[model samples]
Target: MINEVILDDFSLKVTSFEQGVSTSSSGTEAKTIRFDFEVRGGTEYHDVTVHLYKNTFDVKVPELDLSFRGTINNYSTSRTDFTNENSSSLFRLELIEIG
Candidate 1:
């Protein structure tokens, strides 16, 4: 089964964009539009949590696919990397960006 990562209330800001050590004031030169914040939810009860980074892939619309990176529990601390662990559970969380 394929999982989808949803981007709700998504907004990106271009703080700076440089090419070959030169900054471009024009919007065309903007290379990085940071998705500083986002909200994610799961459809399954045991969907766990979703952790995001630049390396992660984006999910399609309508369905929000979530991927979490961390300890399942402090006592158990089982490390897992799954695309579809708990697809039936529904969960939501906020993603905040701090510079």
Candidate 2:
């Protein structure tokens, strides 16, 4: 289903996001999102943020998470590319692990 998502014009609207966690102590979990979009000229990789919510289902999280936005540029398909907008010195981005 994720492979079906497309990026439009190197720009994508983040629909939904979540931090992947594991119950086992030996495993390491991080934040991720259900990034979806389709763009002409391919989507540009950029530094985006995953806002951590204090209260579940809180709308105010967006504003609070603005500061914690991380730079993670993952392209599910070849249609996406890196651009100036998303090229930040803070974080580096790479391709998603697809199997």
Candidate 3:
């Protein structure tokens, strides 16, 4: 699990994080990391979009002592159920490492 993720000048305290690696028959390998977290009190959608628009960015996971140069392969956000008024906006980010 990753406790924190640093993307360029922005830092997020992630609620949950997962990382995976896969290899194809041709020996090509891919490294990916996914993060699940929330943003509160502001327009999180706009803020996140601006930072992730870059072709590539550096990600640092302090808990794993790992750094990756990656691209944003996928991203999604969903508002919390209406019943849970206290819940914050949930966001998911998936990044694939580049060669």
- Candidate with top TM-score is 3
Worst 10 residues of 1 by lDDT: 69-78
lDDT of each: 0.25, 0.29, 0.78
Q: For model 2, give the 10-residue run with minimal summed lDDT.
A: 51-60
In model 3, state the lDDT of residue 93: 91
Cα lDDT of candidate 2 equals 0.29
Arrange candidates, best TM-score first: 3, 2, 1
Write the residue-wise lDDT of candidate 1 on 1-92 in tens digits: 11332433322221221112113455232111111221223332122233332323232223222322211111111233334534222122
RMSD, each candidate, Å? 14.2, 11.8, 3.7
- Tally clashing residue pairs in candidate 1: 8
lDDT of 2 at 50: 23
Model 2, stretches more than 4 Å misplaced? Answer: 1-11, 15-19, 22-25, 42-74, 78-99
TM-score of model 2 relative to the true fold?
0.28
Q: Quick one: ranking by lDDT, best first?
A: 3, 2, 1
Give a tens-digit lDDT track for model 2, residues 1-99.
222211211223333333342233555443333444322331323222222111111111232241122333343433333454533222212222111
Q: Per-residue lDDT of 2-23 in model 3, one digit per residue for the tens?
A: 6788887688889889999867
Question: Model 2, residue 45: displacement in angstroms?
Answer: 9.3
